[model samples]
Target: MIIRILFLFTYLLFSAQLFAQVIRYNTVDFSGMAPFWQVESSLIKDTEPDPDEWNALFDAPPYQILMAGGFSQKEFEQQLRLAFMPSMGSLLRKELDKNNPKSNFLRHVMQIMGNEKKLKELQANLQKAQLIKTALSMAKELLPDSFLYARALPPVSFIICDKAISHAPTGVIIDLLFSMDFEAYVPYFIAHEAYHFYRAKIKVPNLPGHNQPEYPIIQMLTQMETEGIADQIDKKKFFLNRGPFAGYEWARSYQHYLAKSPQAILQLDEYFIRMATVPNSDSKIIEDLLPMNGHPTGYYMANAIIEKMGKRTLIQQTANPFAFIRLYQRVALKDKKHYPPFSSITMQYLRKLEQKYYLPKKAEQPKQKSSPKLMWYEKDKVINNW
Candidate 1:
């Protein structure tokens, strides 16, 4: 029995050594990436650590790399070097700034973990193996950009991890399951957050009476606006066959959600009606849960205005959310044929501007060519153009 135990221990130690020796890469192939984007992975293995400590030593690199040919440690590092330039200065800065507020925040969380005897218990609940696998799958599909462009400032970074937490570099880290599912919902979610980010950066003005002063109300309204616009874009693009996915369910759900607010309904009717008249009107499903007391109508209208303006204009005009509103009101008022009594007159000019500049051009189809002729030789005869 003693000899058997000793043999098993020896085997375990050897296996640990093999696992520890595995090299992981920290770079992404950007050559084939789209304009202003490159995909990156988050995990990499360390070399200096003892074999038994491999799991404890897995570091989240700034970026992850897809290796070439083999999964061996040497190939991993070779691919890493090919894809990224490691800056000692950046590393030094990150290390030295441990006392910064973000770092402090992380420190506080770490302390909490230490004090809460249940920290390990919670960690165990996370199922790290499952999280890592999910993250790997997401990395394969999303092809997330390793670097952000100067002009393209994403408001929220979708992170996949075991726990639900927020980090400075990572943005929001939900369970790896949510992050994996994010691929299905990301187009709309990204659009929504991007609007809010643009608005914050530009200091957009809030509505008069609707100017949010408290927490839930402000958060709710902001979410409504962001999500509403995202839904509109998704519907329009999808219906026209220009977007990643095809469907109108998400867009209708957004409209329905917005209509639930009475205050928004009173202010946004005309806008919604206009949106409902857009190319894919049948896709919108406004429930009869609320009467036409202007509240529900107003909510849809607001979304329509944002939708009509499109993302480029939204980004540019986001300096003042009020400006967009004012512009929308003006255009709504000027359309004598469709204008409501209180609609702002700037609508006409905005409409003209949209007609002149905002409409997206249709994608061109590739030209077709005639099929090529083939030649064949049989055992006894030669055939041409077969």
Candidate 2:
């Protein structure tokens, strides 16, 4: 018995060390922004940047991700140009022949960059924050079992950009201008996005058929599971003042949407009923019911699972959205007064969809000392088709 206890202790220690070694954080990719920042700090703030000076940015890993997602080189260039030379806004409008919403927003970003005082302050804050290191530590603490859920932990590349978004090919995009606004909560935001990046690596099933109603239904279920689980990592912290920037705009938006989730869930139930009954109904019709890409509704269901079933159960079933929905139904049915349960028909339809499309492989005992590494070449292939 003593020997067995010792062996267990040794195994746990070894596993912890291996987990630490596997997940890596990188900011070398963000060095691509150095030249652009240099140009911005120059007195030629109003002058259009020479295309060559900032052109290399489009080839950066994060921008390469944008291209893989179907953005064109011309569109990428125009976006960077808008940020780099906000003073040329008039000329940009004339060239484009109409107002571009993204360009309009970047023009405002340029106004801040054009101000030397604000620009220096922003740069100084970012340098002082040690964001990458802090975020890495936070991610480890927030989701210690990330490796168990994901096949491998790819190097998380932190890129400075004008907007925040999830599951970039390499990692998460951080909006440089708004980094300070997040302040002490940067780690939380980064950790949230890191969950998304890791979760994105999980593979789902193939489509049922070409232009089939099942396609949209599968897409909706996938989004709900994806955003729901990721939101579990960070959204609650925002609500509870777990960070310095509590009640910030983004947090407030999440809070607002979450409050509306009950209604949304009810509406979603109705949609699911239609999906189950109306054979020829366009599954795309349900798109209108999902606000904020189904984050709030998904988050609500995830919270239910965490409350009734357990976080471990949710994490263990991370690869299966069908499992996620069923778990939520179990919780909701138990508390029918407070939680609206899915109709039997809707539940049956969902199960039918799952069985038809999702083919789960048999569970195997995890190999000891298994260290799966997702290399850049493999990552690039994933992004190319992403």
Predicted model with the maximum TM-score = 2
Q: Highest lDDT: give the candidate number.
A: 2
- Give the distance in Å from residue 30's predicted Cα in candidate 1 to where it truly belongs: 16
Tell me the TM-score of each prediction against the true structure: 0.32, 0.68
Model 2: per-residue lDDT, tens digit, 17-110? Answer: 2222433445423444565565465424566656666565555555555455554667645665655565756766764555565645555455
Q: Taking the tens digit of each residue's C-alpha lDDT, what string does model 1 give over 131-210?
A: 33333333222122321122333122222211232222112122222323233343333343333333344332332233
- Give candidate 1's TM-score: 0.32
State the local distance difference test value for candidate 2.
0.61
Q: Count steric clashes of candidate 1.
A: 22
Q: Which stretches of candidate 1 lie over 4 Å from their true place?
A: 1-188, 191-195, 203-255, 258-263, 267-303, 306-316, 334-386
RMSD in Å for all candidates: 22.5, 17.0
